[model samples]
Target: MRALLLTAVAVAVALPVIPAQTWSTTACGPAAVSVGDYRQYEGTGSGTTPFSFTVTVTTAPGCTATGSVAYATEHISTGPADITATSGTLTWTDSTDAKLVVVGVVRDGTPEPEEAFSLRLHTPQNLVITRDRGRGQIIDDDLPPVETGLDGGKICWRYESSAVEVGVHTNTPARAPITVHYRTVHTGSNPPGYYPVKDGIITIPTGSTRGTATIRLKTEPNLPDEQFYVEIFSPSAGTLGLSRVPITVKSKR
Candidate 1:
C-alpha cells in the first residue's frame, strides 16, 4: 500500500475585482469646451488697416463631438459695428481645436486707456461648456502732441428736433482719455431761455478723434430764431484747438 500521506492541499481563494468609478455616461459625455482671452494693440492708421486679434477654443481630450460650436460677442466700450462681426462659429472635431478671429478697424486717434469687449460661448451641441466669456482688450497706440478741438462747427436745430449731437475733436489721437470742459456762452446775438444752461465735460476715448455730447433744445414755435455758442476750454490731456462752435435754433415752420 502506497503510503497515502494525507498531504493538506492549500487552495488559493480568488478575490473579486472592483471596477473604476464611472465619471461619464453615454448620454452625459466627457466632452468640454474652453475659451481663451486675448489682448492686442488697437493698431494705427499707418500701421495695419484692419487689425486683428484671436481667441482660442479648445475641446477636451475625451471630446467626441463632430460638428461646430457657435459664439457671440458683446461690445463693452466699442460699438457693435466697430468690431467686424458680432457672432460667429468655431468648427471642431474629436481631436481638433478651434479659433475665433476678431478683426477690427485701426482708427487713428489719441492715446488713451485700454478698451475691452466680451465674447460668449453658445450652442454647445451636447458638449460641456467648461469655460466661457473671453475678455478682449484693445491697447491704444497713439502718442503725444494730440491737439483737441470742437466738432460740428455750426449746426441748426429745428423746433421739431428735441436734441442735437455736438462733439469735440482732436487733431491727432491721444494715448489717454481726455476730458474737455465746455460751456454754452450766451452772447448779444444769442440770448437765454431758448435753451438751458449747459456746462459739462466730454470725454474722448483713446484712439478716437471725437467725443460727443447731446444738447437738448427748447421748442419755441412762436419765438424768433436764437443762436448760442459752445466753447470748450481746459482739457485734461492735449491742447485745445477750435474751441468755439455755434449752434442756431430755427423757429418752427
Candidate 2:
C-alpha cells in the first residue's frame, strides 16, 4: 500500500488561510471527507512548479472508505478544458489519511490580475464528504505594461552654462534595462559659436524609473534667443509617450 506521508512543507502541516466560501456537509457511511484550507502561490510563467492541494478523510472506528474528487478552474487555465482532474481517488484507512493533488498554473505574456481555481469532492464509497471544496489563489507576478517619455515638456538653458540636464522618465519601473534615444533638432538657427548637435542616450537600469541626458550648449553675447527641439524616440523597451520637447537657449546680456 503506497501511503502518502505529510512532508515538512506540506500545506496541511502549515497553518492555512481560512477560505471565505462556505462548505456543505453530507452524512458519511462511517467516515467523513474534508479538504485542507486554501492555498496560494505566485504565478511565474513556468510549467515545472505547481500548486499543491491536500484532500483529507477523517475515519471513525473501523471505518475504511473510498471516494473520488474533481478539480475545476473557475478563473484559471489548467488544461484544454481548464479541468485538472475528472476522477481523482481518495481512500481512508481506519486512521486519517490525506492525498495531495499537484496542478500547474498556465502562463502567458499578457499581464493579468490575481486569479483562482477550485477542487470539489464527489462519489464517495462508504464515506461522507463534509467540507468539499478547496480554493487556490494565484498572485500575479508579471510586470504591467509601461510607457516612457520626457519628464518635462520644456527646459530653459542659460547662455553661460556649458550643459543642461534633461530628465527621462517612465510611467512605471523598468522590468529590464531600457535605453532612451534623444537628439536636439534645429527649430531655428543654431546659437552662435561652435554649437554641436546633441545626440544622447539615457540608460534606465532594470528596476529603475528614471534617467538623465545632458545637452551641451554654446552661446555668444548680444545674440537673439534661439530655440531647439529635443526629440524623444527609439526606446529599447517601452512605447514612447511624449515625443517632442522644446528648449530655449538665452543669449548672454
Candidate 3:
C-alpha cells in the first residue's frame, strides 16, 4: 500500500512539468515548378487551433497563383488526432524561365517547422547566355580559386530586355547560379597558357543594349595547365539552363 501511494504521488507531481509538443508537415519542402507553372497545397491541423503556412523561394522571379498565393482555411474542432494528415500538393509550371522553391510550416499557434523544405529544377538559371564564340565552342577547365590562382575566366556574358528583366532574378540567393553564366577563355587556345584569378564568379555591368567583359579563373603552376572547366549558366529567358565550358590552357612561356 505504501509503494502504491508513492507511485500515485509521483505521477501527480510530474503532470504539471510537461511541455507542449510541436508538430509540422512537409508541404513547403523544396517545391519544384516549371516556368509559368503553379502548385496547390493542403494539410490537416491539430486540436482546435487553426493551421497556417507561408512560402518563399529564395530563387525568386517566382510567384503564387493569381500573382499571389491561393489558400483556404479549415477548422477541426472535434476529431481524433490522426498523423495521416497530408499537406497540399502545389500545382505550377514554367514561368519567367524556371524557379526554386522553399516553404515554411506552422501548427496549433506554434511555428515549429522553419525552413523545413526545398526544391531544385532545371529551368532558367540565366536570361541570356552565349552558346559558343563565332566559330569556336566556349571552354574553361581550371577550377575555383581555392587551389588555383584564378577563379573563372574572361568569358563574355550577353543579355537583352527579351533575355532578362531588371528584377527577373532578384530572388536568386547568389548573384548568379552556375547556369546563368558561361565560362570560356577570352580567346580559345589562342596561345594557351597559365591564367589565374582570385575567385570563380565574374562581375559585369548591365548594359542597356549589350555588354562584354573578361573574367579570370584561379590557377596553380603545379596543376595541369593544359585543360580546365569553365562554368556556364544560361538565362531562363523563358526557362533555366546551366552549362559549362572547357579550356585548353596553353603554356604562356
Model 3: runs farther than 4 Å from truth? 1-213, 217-224, 234-237, 240-242
Residues 1-253, candidate 1, lDDT per residue (tens digit)? Answer: 7887798899999989999877764452545666777665455443232333343444445445555667787778876644655577776665444555565534545676767787777887645677777777765655544567877655565666877667778877645566677788876554553455467778877677788766777666666677777888766544567888888777766
lDDT, candidates in the order shown? 0.64, 0.62, 0.26
Off by over 4 Å in 1: 1-143, 188-193
Model 2 residue 55 CA deviation in Å? 48
lDDT of 3: 0.26
lDDT of 2 by residue, 26-145 (tens): 544656777754543233333322566788776655455655444443434333433244345655555466778776655443566656667666676666778877776654434454
Q: Of 1 and 3, which scores higher on TM-score?
A: 1
* Worst 10 contiguous positions by lDDT, candidate 1: 44-53
The reply for model 2, stretches above 4 Å from the true place, is 1-143, 155-157, 190-199
- How does residue 173 of candidate 1 score in lDDT? 67
| Model 3 agreement with the true structure over 1-253: per-residue lDDT tens digits | 4555434443434446667887653332233223122221112132221122333322233432222222222223212231123333333333323222322222222222211221212222222111111110111111110011223232212211111111112122221111123344344353333343223342222221122223343343433234545443333111221234444443323
Report the CA-based lDDT of candidate 1 relative to the real structure: 0.64
